[model samples]
Target: MSENKTSIRKKHMEFTPMVPETTFQYADLSIKHIDAENTLAMVRRAIRMGYDAVAINIDLGDISDYYTELDMLWTPGSQNNVDGEPPKKKKKKQQRKDELADGIAGILKKKLIPPPHYVDVSQLNTSELEKRGKVFRQFSRITFTANEQVVINKVFIHPTILSYDIVAVRPGEPSVLDTLSRKTELFDIITIDHLEEERRKWLSVSKVMDRIRNDGVFYEIAYAESLMPATRKNTLFNGRVLIRSLKSKNIIFSSGAETMLDLRSPVDVMNMSLLWGVANNEARKMISGFPKNLLLQAECRGTGNGDVCSMKLSDAEKLAGNGEEEEQDGASEEKVVVGKEEEAEKVKAPPIEVRMNHSQYQALLQATKNANDMMKKIKASKAASSS
Candidate 1:
């Protein structure tokens, strides 16, 4: 118990208050699946390598019959033109239709499972790693597979999709990329699958990349693809094009590993990024800073203009520790003061020995015993009266 208290105090002393934790120092934001055991092992491996977070990705095959941006103009709470007068009833007819469509979409969404969450950092004890000042956070991500231009505005607001912390779209059409690049609120990341030859054309020129960057959306590079023989050349070639276009801004590297074997450490990914002509600092930022901004952007998409924040538990924990320490210090000081006062009261003259006849000695001893008993009774009475 003493050891535990000492260790806790040491951690609290080292902590910085209100300063944001470097939670995104090394994040594997794309973990491919939600397998119970395999994902757990992969996350454990990631944590061991100092990754702060992972997003369990669930594939959204296609977003169909979603409410469009135009539809919101007629809805009760219009996303745009809030200062303008409420839309007339004639304009609201379309919103009513969209609401009916939304009902159907909600019914369809009922069959879908919400993203899985793993609250434990380790198997042994959840608090163990926290005590050691390390944290592993898990988030849910939905990667929508967009195969058409209509797919962009066609995404329905499914409850499950809204529940996810990250929204990543995999576009098969260049039009989808062009559209999503401007509408940043719709998604957080635009992921490209390097395995397909045609997917190269999906990235056209600097125009789309500029819009994406201006909007604060990140283009994710799955580093695991580089480990493949056939896809390696394409990954490098296209990656170079993206870096040239975006100038290494708003780009984040994630494992996107389907299994533990495909997983690469952040250091390894940083080294591999050199092949794309990214400098050391830029490569480091890809795993740390860019992803940090990406998560903030994602949370904003879900919360709109609201003041929602995703903060580490460590800061709040430090506050609680500070409060507890102050209380303990005050208590200890009070104990010291009380001890001194009690000692002063306990001070008394010591008994002196004197040679005497046995009878005289016995009488004196009895008298002393009676006097001690009387003193104890008087002290008890005084204590009761004081209370």
Candidate 2:
């Protein structure tokens, strides 16, 4: 029991919580699929806990019908404009027909609800609107995939900057838009795992962060705890490099947490910030102030009144040396072994043929006989052909 206690203590000392700068909250906007009351409760909890911001994910499955209905409803009035006109009983039957169509239109319009803050584009389905407008906002924001291509061609390429993920960029390759036009810029908030793979393939996180910092692109980095286990080495290394190299003012720490269950309490994230060298006030600003400001942009205020401790400097310095040496050494050794010798060994091995399961010596004998038989058959065929 005493020995077990000592072992447990040692393990505890070695354990470092894999917490990062940001946590992201993912929210589904499906009114029917999601329990509204439960969702509100979770949102309230997140608000109380001080989570940075919530990412509202609107998938195509959620709003396909809405968009289709909207398209159908707007098809009739594609060119019609209702000017103020008095009611005439002579046109009562025509008016009744118009009234019924209008009633149906109203219902369809109500049903074609877009995601919050999203502007609907299905209504402005005119060639004139398309030509005159630089970009039109899609009414059904939930149809992300179907509308993404449309957005890129009609919206992103326009003078306006659209805030959707560009699906075209592949690993180790420059963005299609990047190669095509200097004026067009691609921005995305990739997972730490994806970023790590990209970093490994081309540039380090510091290099990427530096480029973004210099380029002045508006972007956010969200920390995913679920991805942490799979991306342990890259997460720690990249995060350390990023925090060290990038200006704190440029970096936005977010909860990349997907659901309410996935979220850690704001206090927990605050504690994580402390671990990551953030002062309490600075941590509060990153978690609450920065995200609200960026998401709300002009409307949100920047002042964050939170307790900040002066001991953060000494505390960070003290914790700086924790497990770094072990991680670096382990990563280096693994990379060296994986890169060189493994492929060479595969090429050097000779191909062997065997008919059936047998003893090792029997299998060898069978393989030898098979090879000799094939050689003899080849010689016989050659002789026959010559003759």
Of the candidates shown, which would achieve the greatest TM-score relative to the real structure? 1
Give per-residue CA lDDT, model 2, range 97-189, as digits (tens). 687788676565643333232222242233432343322111111122221232234322221112221211212223422321222234332
lDDT of 1 by residue, 275-348 (tens): 88999989989887788778777766744353333334443332223223322222211111224446422111
Off by over 4 Å in 2: 1-41, 51-55, 58-211, 214-219, 226-228, 274-281, 296-387
- TM-score each candidate: 0.60, 0.36
Q: What is the Cα-based TM-score of model 1?
A: 0.60
Steric collisions counted per model: 0, 9
Distance from true location, Cα of 275 in model 2, Å: 4.9
What are the candidates' C-alpha RMSDs?
A: 21.4, 29.0
